[model samples]
Target chain A: MQPTETFFSGFAPHDLWFLGEAALRTLWLSLLAISIGSMIGVVFGWLLSVSRIGGGFVLSPLLDIFRSVPLIIQLVLFYNFAPIIGLRLDAFDAGLIVLIVYTSANVAYVARGGIEAVSQPMRRAARSLGMTYWQDMRYVVWPIGLRAVFPAWVGVALGVMKDSALVSVLGYVELLKASQILITRTQETILILAIAGAFYFALSYPISLYAAHLEDRWNQ
Target chain B: MDYNFHWRPVFKALPDLLQAALLTLEVAAISMILGVLIGLGLSLIRIHMKGPVMWLASIWVELARNTPALLQLFFFGFGLGAFGIHFSPYLIVLMGLTFNNAGYLAENFRGGFGAVPDTQIRAARSLGMTAFQTYTRIVIPQVLRIVYYPMTNQMVWAVLMSSLGMLVGFRELSGETQFFASRTFRIFEYFAVTAVIYYIIVKIILGASRLLAMRLFRY
Candidate 1:
């Protein structure tokens, strides 16, 4: 017990390796979730921004309800409910699905803003050139819309990375969960946590800095 | 076809949930108060200070803002135990919430401060106002008006994130919901009630903030 205790001291080589592995897992999950979620977000956002509420006030209300529910509740629902429907997922898969859906809700908002930022004059110009609505969107609207909202996408991406840690509640072996495990196993809680904190900082800082840079560039 | 909804259990659980809801409100309220003070101080330093102080503030803000609040809670709760700095679970939760909220609030405040036009600052200085007076009397009030919406948004996020306190054994609303779910094996009911309470709290906070903004900043 004494050697085992002494061997697993704070900042030990093996512990550092463990932390590194955890960080990698965290990054992987964040990337996977964000990639899938952002794709869905773009489509949902396009529809949200373009759809006219001619008669279906019902659609808007449903979107409101979906957006209002907490992400954690959504996670728990998918975790438990999916099994009963025979679409069983492991904890990781369930967490990933929850993150994708939850993040898509937010991304859709950003996307809508992005799409709406394109000027009416640009649309008219595209139409005058004999372009159809779909062609105008493909050739003119989307490019400008995406550029205008690039900074917003950066913010949303940072959000996804931070929220990825929440999946640890369901026992996923992400960086935060790994830190919890280390605390129980090695008893060097503070040092390991500090390392975990540094890992998160490493992941998030550059993205935020890049967002700030893009905002400056665009504003100028 | 045989399924029938029952309100009896949900109604019976209300008093317990309400007690826990009180705890949740207490945590969010206290943390937001403290967070605003600390955040304002940090924002001042970030904006007005030079060199090392600004860098230190930036680092602190980045670290707190970037990580998940749950990780911060765990670090403060379990991590501190290793350094012989144990806090009660409630205190740890409060500390984590305050630290996390302060980071975002500082940024919101910094953005607000930026919104204060430079010409006004120059005008105040030209009229023989000290830098401190210019900031307090001329800049901060205007900045507050500009930041009202974003600040409200941050407050809403803070309230929502407070639910994470349950992970560290703090018996806030989410924790109580988990307890009920496990005890009664009525996971769906417990969670449904939790979601409704959260939605109501968020809506109330938003409404109250909007009202306060109108009252305070009405020109």
Candidate 2:
């Protein structure tokens, strides 16, 4: 494990491929968490919007814990705590669990906001048009509410992707962790970091720009 | 799940953990102050300047905003070390957090500045106020007011983000927790306590911000 003189190698051609694979891991991890967590979050968000006392008293504070504490702590806590609780989970699973809840906590608020953005009169109009409650929700609320919060949800998704770097603490070989490993072996810190940063920027910047564009268009 | 929980070790380390928590707050506070100052300068540069310096500011803002914070910390840690410029872990964390905060705050400041209409600057200029006077007395105050809530949220973000200090070997709250958990092997218990401390810290920051907002914005 000692980084002796010969142990340190220069960056080689294959290193780019290594980084690409690691980037894929980051993508999949965040994608899994966002998709599943969004589903759960939207349901909970709907509940929160409909039931003042139940959601406020019970679910809101429950989810708020994930928001308030640092993701690093939550990752560490869940990773270590899982073994004690007989979960027998590995790093990826533990990281995924924490990421899922963190994503859900965030998406819940956005989903609730999206739900609330559809005015009462609008929902009532849909209902008075002989639509059932579910029909009103599915036909009327979802479209308008989604447009209002799509940008925010994109922000959350990007935030979670960047925050996935913290999952490296659990020894998951995501993009950042892969860079750390390469830095140790190659001793090419700046080069490897630049490459890794480019990978992230390539992934993040265009999405953010597109989100901004959509927001501008919608606002207009 | 037959694991015996050990609260005693965590309780014994409570004072040290609390002290580390204070260090976390201190670093976050210092970074926030530095971030706001640098961010103000950066936003001004973006607004008033062109060419390489403005491009540099944009790159700084975009890179910091787009990249992972831990990667930025590593850039300060080992990336700088590659050039024979070394920093203590504490400085690495401080610099990294400040750099990230500055990037984010700069964007917020730009948005805040954009919210102020062109007419106000014109009015301030027409009053024969110097450029400095116009910005200091007229423009900056309004921008600050517009960005006050965002600044508060950013402060909360700074506190939470400082937990990354542990990765760089800085003995902040999360680092200290990791240290104790390693020693006592009471990982769950120690982190549970640490999480509560963080929650309290966030709540206090939010409460104080609200109270300060009441006083400062009572027009």
Candidate 3:
């Protein structure tokens, strides 16, 4: 088939509406997942830094297991296992849950780094000032730690967005799955895929650019 | 459906799964080697290449870095076939992974290269070394030392990303697991086994890389 023939044939008028809906779903799902994931990551990360179990030599290996496992495998496990535990969710929910768990693992690591970046002198000074641990953390340590690791957090956020595409395999009507559906129905494989790629770029590039700006601004 | 946990089927599948695991390693190793070379070249261009070459390299790096590898794999696997250009699924997956890894690796390498102190380069030049010799003798070695940990992390990430190849029918570990699960209706057993395999592979790679880095780059 001629490339143009394939391209033109693939651009069905009605499919545009379907693609739009899919795009919206993808964006909504991704935003929700990332927001929740970030929360989990922040909390877990803070715990990792402050908790006694998180402080010792065992911390590295504990984090290692979370870091080493693939997010896709984690998703598959959740997708299959969630129903068995009475918390039944559709593909989208399962995907979001897995995203939270997987990205939290990363966030915990980033958060730990952020916490560590808070200088010892600062913590000592906070203690000397009669600030309680919570007060010191809330008023001083967390601020510095957050600033130090904001760039990495942004990168992780972007990672969550991109990794969201993996959820398409679980039958979520994500952008990639939408494109795959279009490809199968119309067989305009390249054009639709390119459009899908463009959609992903549209979704992710702005956040990345924003991250670059924040990194520069924060570093300055 | 009662989930029956059977060790026999999982054990019976081990040899085939091991073969698949070996293929996964083969693909990852080849892709990483190529990715490192491409990433090094790209880093050089980003740092030193003049004019359009630099601009193009930066754009490539940004585009690849921002995009998901799964989309890239699909594009290479399915998109190219529409244009009368065909490669095996394995090659397409490899190319996709290589490009993805190269972009990240380029950034890592650039960071490493930038971390090298200017004084060291100056000292090398002052010793009558040419630019190339100075880079190879002094700058590159030091940069590698600085970037060893991050590079190892990226290599681990590369191994994990290889799981996405299953989506394109490349029959890596994940692919084999999915196949067996579907055929046998042993979802948990198959996935759990493969997950364990993946964890083992990652652990071994991480451990090996750490030792190798310590030996190679120890000051």
Indicate which candidate wins on TM-score.
2
Chain B alone: TM-score in each candidate? 0.92, 0.98, 0.95
lDDT of 1 by residue, A95-140 (tens): 9888887767778778888878998898999999999999998988
TM-score of chain A of each: 0.89, 0.96, 0.87
Query: A147-185, model 3: which lDDT tens digit per residue?
Result: 898888888888888899899989999888998988887
Alpha-carbon runs more than 4 Å astray in model 2: A1-5
lDDT of 3 by residue, B8-82 (tens): 787899999989999888888898899889999999999988899999889778878877889888888888888
Fraction of native contacts (fnat) of each candidate: 0.50, 0.86, 0.69
Tens-place lDDT per residue, model 2, A1-220, is 8966586778999988998899999999999999988898899899889888889889999998999999999998888888877888988999999999999999999999999999999999998899999999899999999999998899899899999989999999999989889989998899999999998889899999999899999989
Would you estimate the TM-scores of all the predictions? 0.91, 0.96, 0.93
Find the candidate with the highest DockQ and give its number.
Answer: 2
Clashes (candidate 2): 0
What lDDT is reached at residue A123 by model 1?
Answer: 90
Q: What lDDT would each prediction earn against the true structure?
A: 0.81, 0.92, 0.84
TM-score of chain B of 3: 0.95
- What is the C-alpha lDDT profile of model 1 across B143-208, one tens digit per residue? 888777877777777667777877777788888888877787767667787888888888788889
Which numbered prediction scores highest in lDDT against the true structure? Answer: 2
Q: Rank the candidates by DockQ, best first.
A: 2, 3, 1
Better of 1 and 2 by TM-score: 2
